[model samples]
Target: MAEKKFESDAKRNERLYVLYYIFGAMFIILLGALAYRQIFMYGYYHKKGMLQTQRRIIQPGARGDIYDRNGRLIVGNRPVFDAVVYFNDARFDFRKEYARLNKLRKQNKEPFDYSKLAIAARTNVLQSYIDEINSILKTDFVLDADFNRHFSGRQLMPLPLVKNLSISQHAILAEKLRVDNSAVQIYTDTYRYYPYADRAAHAVGYIRPEIEQVDPDIPGDDLRTFSFLGKIGKSGVEKAFEDRLAGETGAEIWVVDHNGFTFEKIESKPPRKGGSMQVSLDMELQGAIEDAFPNRKGAAVALDVKTGEILAMVSRPSYDPNTFFPTMTHAIYNDIRDRGAWLNRATQGLYPPGSTFKIITALAGIKSGVIGPDTVSYCDGYYQVGSRKFPCHNRYGHGEVNLQQAIEKSCNVFFYEHGQKMGIDSIAKTAKEMGLDSPTGIELHEESTRLTIVPTPEFKRKQGSGWSKGDTANVSIGQGDLRQTPLQMACFAASLARGETRTKPSILHDTTRKTDMKYHGAKKLDIPKSGYDAVIEGMVNAVERGTCRRAAIDGVKIAAKSGTAQVMVKGRKLTLAWMIAFAPVENPEIAAAVIVEGEEPGDASGGATAGPIMREMFAEYFKGRQVAQ
Candidate 1:
């Protein structure tokens, strides 16, 4: 009995020994794994953890401000909130759920395409979320197709579902998102704001939404995947100085929790603000000049003759640049574009100079020795050129007239004879020297300075055509291909006032400039002072008692010339009325050019149409000067 009991004890001891060996082996394996993790594998795990919890965020800075010459704010930026969706994060959560189902389906031994099922499930989830958002915001959020496309093409970018959100809308979205911790985000952003609405709409310009990459070779850790870079300038001064106006981008380091909620800010660098712009624009005078125009399809410009400083420039039928922001409605865009409202007519509209070209022709004839100051020409209602009668503006001409009287009366016969005598080449040379064939060098991006038609023998030769007596007669009267922008005419009038060519026309204020304003190239006309006085006398006489009598002011002496040009518009004949003038002629302060387009055939001459506008502009200038004194 004792031997059997001892044997039973030994059997129990053997079982205990077997259990101890197994536990000892397990402990050694666990200790080795701990040592390996703390040593060789530590860097890999630490990197993985950091990638999950730490993130880099980019912050976009605000655009700069724009101010007029009088220090009034013309353009600025305003804070806005945008509702966006980070599709990558949403896809991550969707795939996690899909993997759980995938495991269950695999356990059940079901044959199914995992990729196809995952896509269907993700689409349904996203649609349901959009439906919820729509209910809260009371909007029809139909972004299914756009979401699919963005997910395929730009998955890292945050898709902006709604921009420029109202305060109430933002509040509701924040509250709803807080409870569910959804992948949707509300980001703080900025959009351009024009306080004066349509005032200075063309000169100030507008902005549009765009993504700008600073450097494509930058490391991924330097920027956030879904950061919102603001809109960029699309036209006007905005486009002219885009680099100086668009601010620099910044970055932030954030520590996030396991659920992707940012818990702490590790480090941050604020964005740098852009530089402001100062332009030579007087809002008050601009409004006045625009209001003085007779038609809504023409242009007007007033210049400080001595300095070539543009005091006022007005292009009719202008559109509000603010309408371009946050996406313009198709109807409004089409309407404005169709009406030619986007055209800057002050420096871009091309029209015949009419009798104003007589100024250049008279100078050419005198300079070329084809005519003297006392050269007399007969105007018996018409002039004979190759059997065709070129009728004068005055059907019953001034019988016989000299240079001064012809200019005052705008007799076509006097200019016709001189133009044929000197030919188109002489006239074109004088015109080019007087700053007529080049741009005025204004700061606007839309200024157009296409070569004006001179119709010289060389010009005709290049066109596979030849000069004829009729062509010479037409060129003399500013008809046919002769075209000039109002800005050019203003410069011409200014040059006449200063007795030299002044080509610099700037939109930047002298006071705001950091350096001296560069000299715009000029040419000295060597004509005798008596010649200038003779032409000035005729222009003054025109305003005093001739056709431009409407432009004469009570206390100011204004030298003036009026022109009526014929043009074809939409298969219909139209007349463009023009007036170029300088006030207080002896010591001119302002030189102006005004044009009213698409006037009726019998609509009073340029004197009656554009003359009053010039008179009003000059009156305002003198009134301001008087008040200032």
Candidate 2:
């Protein structure tokens, strides 16, 4: 019995040993799992999340440059350095940082002055950062409210380092950005700049923030890629050649760190730099023309009388366009807006051609053979048309004047007599053919118009006013239904010089785009050479010895006409000054038109206001040229 008990106890001892071994193995496994969890799972993941994100720096494509006919830079883009903050790269432990700073302050003997300490701390931080930056770069960084604003709003986004950097500085920054792989990065951002802003602001209009994405007519590229980029031209030549001035935008892959910092970059495409623009403008002439006006609002356009290429266009009271790039403030914008300073008055504003329209009437009369160059008309100080007596501006009638004398003296009766003979329809038709009733297609924004000549019953139905013969008589002298722009007047003078009726006036001249010069199935207006010559001679006489006597140039002979259109505002008559001139008399090279509005209620005339501007322009331009031998 004892031996059997011993055997059972031995078997039980062996089972107990196996069970002990199994329990010891399980405990060792559990302890290893706990150690692994404590060392590498949750804690490791959090540390991994704390690492700053690295993003690849993206380069913005440059906008094209704008130049004059001589390739002088009119408008261009300049680089600027801006401090940029990568939100994702920024440390997010603001509370912990505040606590640490508080501990540092307490450890020192500094008093509890939170405001002063906070300011000093911020300044110290900025200074330290700038100092470190200066260590790498040999330039200084300025800290201002703009940085504060960006910091308060977007700590992750990078702030501008420097604005309005020079080309040399831009080169330095670009080279540093490409070569250096430091933790902090700086890149170049270009802003629109106008070097000759005073010279061609009206012709090369300013830019504004576009409301949305700009899509070009060209295929193979998406304009949306530049949705956050610089804008194209908005007005004048800039607006006209916006497509050319704005190049295709390219994009790249930017790998960012956890804190949104720039890391490695993969270029998706190399952005195509925009092409430069060359306009048909002479900067010297433009400056001379702008200097011609003094303290008055006016416009002048000079066109190559032979080629229809615009040389210079001046609009007075023009706003400077240098403030348009990057962004503009409401105060500055409203200052320009309230004064109508930004309006391109030359092409967009309309006014009466005044006495200048008499040339058309003379042509119409001579073309109808109803009156000759020697046609005579007598005025008794005032001519009676039906029941109304129309007074000449002379206040005393120009009596017994022939067409040449009438043109030289601008006698209203000669034109009235001829207008009566030829009828108003003939004059309207002739003027329309001279590029009047529509836009001249000048590549600039314009508001062109046609007169309501002899408003028929159908016209009366459309408009509330009925046709009146008195209106037709007024239209004959450029009064009742007469309106034309300074650019249109310039174009008209150019047509007379070129001797053909094609008009394509513009300040922009792009070699890439071909100009359609043919008038395109347009009707031609025929006039007698004798009549045209007589009137042109009369214009020459006027400039030489009449109302526009002040417009004489030393070397070149300028055939010119003056206009003083009357406007009735609140029962008061206001005169708008006007002048149109073409130089060299026989073979004109340039033609110009100028106008100034809101004259002191009939206190000013075209000869006194607009004509003198032409004189100033001529005096400066014809400085040493020889016209008469």
Candidate 3:
């Protein structure tokens, strides 16, 4: 009995010893694994933790206001609400998800268009949140094709799910998203507004969203957020003065939770607004000019003859720039662009000066010793250059005429004889001297330069042709590729008024105390004073009793010239009527140029079509000055 009990006790002791050894071995192995992980994988885990907790974002600043000369707010910002979603916060892996969707499409035997497949993958990933938003906001929204492009191109920026949200929709989204909204957010954005619509749109310019365009002027380190809301000027004064008008970007560091939700702000920097730009445009006068030529296709330019400052410039068939905001539709953009509504005719539209170029021709003839104030040319109604006979405006002939009488009557035969004698190079040299052949150095984009026909020997060679006497004859009458913008013609009229050439045409007032801010006064021309006096007398006589008699305003002495340019359109001859004038001729203060595209050849006469427009505009401009005096 003793031996049996001892055997049972020994067996039980052995079993307990085995269980202890097994447990001891397992504990040692666990400890070894724990130490290995702590030492070797420290960096990987630390980096992963940091990524989930900290975020740096950029805060975009507001752009500056734009004002007209009268302190009128031509352009400003209006607050709008936009719904945005962050790709990083959503943890969306575009490549992996795209692969998965591609596999499914292959299994389903569907066509493999990579673009469509990509869009499908994006739609699948964003569907859940979109559904939730639709339910909460009581709307039916679809992520369209633009979503694919925007996501692929600018995934670094927040994806705008909905733009310019309504008040009710915004309130509903905010209420529903308060607790579980880490990936989605509603933010305030700005929309540029032009208070006066299309008035002076060409001069004021337009703004567009900063999608993928990186400005060389902006520092890379400044913008930390991919979804920063920024805008840039596309043309006109906005683009020319971009440096002074674009705001600085700022940054903020935030501490976030594991779900990538911002819990608290770690550090922040406020953004700085851009500087305001003050221009020399007058909205009131702009409106008047636009209203005066409703439904007419042409351009007009008015300037301060004393300072060379452009006051009111108008191009007909202008469009409202507001239509380009948020997102422009294909149809709207096509309609505006295809119809040439975006063109700034005052500075970009080129046309022959017609009789207008005679002013320059007369000046050139006088300076080149080809003709003088007393150098008489007989016009038996026609002048022969080769076998072709160029007839004067008066087919019956002025019989014999001098430079002053020739300009007043716009006699083509008189210019033909002198222009042939002076030659193309001489005339071109003098035209360039008066700011005709080159750009006016305006601060606008798309300024058409070198389009005017200087018609020199070099120019003829460049055109793969030779200079001819017939070419010289056509050029003398302001025909055969003699093109000039209305703005340039306005400058010419101003120069004629001042008896000198001035290259300064500014939209900014000279308030800056810097040396560069000084007004560019007129440069005295090298022509004889007799020639200047003779031209001025002819211009005044033109407005008072000659061809431009319609431009004569009551109680105001006006010096003026009229032009009727001919062109062939659709195999038929057409005309463009033009008039240039300055008021109070003795001490001229304002100069203007107007061009009207006549529907018919005979329908367009400089004195009949364009002269009345200048007359009315001049009247409206000086409406109160005479009364007040």
Candidate 4:
């Protein structure tokens, strides 16, 4: 039994010995393979790296210019210098390289003291080495905290230390870099700026520092890896045509040495400049209108009746677009964002139409034959319909008045009855046909308007309610839920004047290149001349001796209507004053609408607030009149 056990132990030992030898051979082979790769691969890369070292300087392309119809420069670029860092090109162990400096300060001579040194003292370090560098550089080289966060994620890209550096600063950077060629490098680029300042800010828009969109043509393979892209328009025409305005950015190959110092070459594809935009804005007329609203808070839109060109569109409480370029700090943004400023009231703001909406009631009453030109409604300060009593604007009422007289005096009682007779459905349909309750479809973004139709079964399903006559009466008189933008009012007024369904208006008269606008669905519209004529006479009387008396321009018989509409925000009632009109009664050329909010006197009417601005715009617009220029 002892001999058999010894034999089993020998066999076990032999198997263990063979397994150990095999393991040793495999380990040595793996080590040798790693060594070979370390030598061969590193050798090839290191050699090529020598021929291709560089400072990794980057260039942001120039921003495009914006021109008005008259070819005047409304927006342009100014040269700016920036303090930037090329992280990948920064030599020395950024972590440890500075470590020795701090250590040296403890005992030995400090080799490089960036912190103790003044801004100029440190401008000549890292990638560049020259005398001229110091002379031209105006900014300090110390990295900022915000920059550090960006650099970590954007290691491959150069960091901008300062943006929109002034002209004097640019001069300093250029001269210094030329003379010294120091360690710190200067990057020059164009920053977006607006010459018009606030004149057309709402239309021209602004830009941000970081690019928001990469080229849509980027390949699937590279898209995931690319970290930064170019600018995006945030609002107005700027946002609407972002693709054309953002332009393109190019890429280059960067190589570095062990020190992470840039010492090689750069090969880059040149970036494509953005396209120039010719806005349909009438600078002269825009300026004139802007001049009219020096202090008042309001907006105005003047339309070309023969064609749908917006002659002038001015949103008051204007902000300098220059504030938005490069970057808009929280403080500056908050200052302008919702301060009743920034809002393009002409195209997007919805207001109660007041007496201006009486035309629609008249049209509905006329069309439905429920009320006639000769039909009379007595307004003894108030109107009675169902369980509701509506008041007339005169307070004492016009007593007994015809449809024309009711419109002339803007009698609310008449419209309240008209709303009851026409009902909500008929009023809604007529209002829609007259260009209310829908977006004017102006080029501006998210243009808002009121819904004319009362909530139907479908609307009820969505809103969880059935239609009511009271609601109908409310909307018909441009109260309750009835709202229309200044642009919509002008468009509808133009329709009433032209008798053809011309579109509301356009920011770009020459839309040959704007593919999106090519299919906007503009078509010829046919409506009964008598229906238009009836509305026209009412508007004419409105201007001759009615609510729109403020809009009367001497030498031109203005057919205008004014409205003092009630607006409620968060259930608090306020009045939004408005006026819509067309001029040169014999041959109409201009259609104008102005809306004013926050006017004093809760009883403030559109005729009082918007009328004068419209009158002023027309006086100047047609001062040197001729057959359509």
By TM-score, who's the top model here?
1
What is the alpha-carbon lDDT for the whole of candidate 2? Answer: 0.69
Candidate 2 on 1-629: residue-level lDDT in tens? 99999999999999899889999999999988887877758677554443333222223357688788878888887766654434333333333444567788889956787755554555455555456555555877765555556544444346555555556655665566556543345546667888876676888886665522433332323111212345656777767776677756554444445433345654465556678877888888888878777666778888877567888888778877777656788988899888778777787777777887777777778788877877899976777788987777787877898877787787887777677677767877777777677767777764444331322234545777776666666767777757788888888877765555656776766455443346322333466778778878888888888878878766677888888888776888888888888888767778888888864687668777887788877776567777662
RMSD of 3: 8.8
After the best TM-score superposition of candidate 4, give how far the Cα of residue 440 lies from its true spot, in angstroms: 3.0
Q: Per-candidate TM vs. native? A: 0.79, 0.76, 0.78, 0.78
What is the C-alpha lDDT profile of model 3 across 133-200, one tens digit per residue?
88787888866547766665555457877778888888888878887654578978888888989888
lDDT of prediction 4? 0.67
Tens digit of per-residue lDDT, candidate 4, span 403-505: 6677667878878877787776666666766556566667767476644333333454577777676766666677765656778888877766665433556
* Ordering by TM-score: 1, 3, 4, 2
Higher-ranked by lDDT: 1 or 4: 1
Assess each prediction's global lDDT (C-alpha) against the native.
Answer: 0.78, 0.69, 0.79, 0.67
**CA RMSD, predictions in order:** 8.4, 8.5, 8.8, 7.6
Residues 493-607, model 1: lDDT tens digits: 9888877765577776675333212365776665766677878888988898887888877778889999988888777788888889997786887888999886456664689
What is candidate 3's CA lDDT for residue 544?
Answer: 80
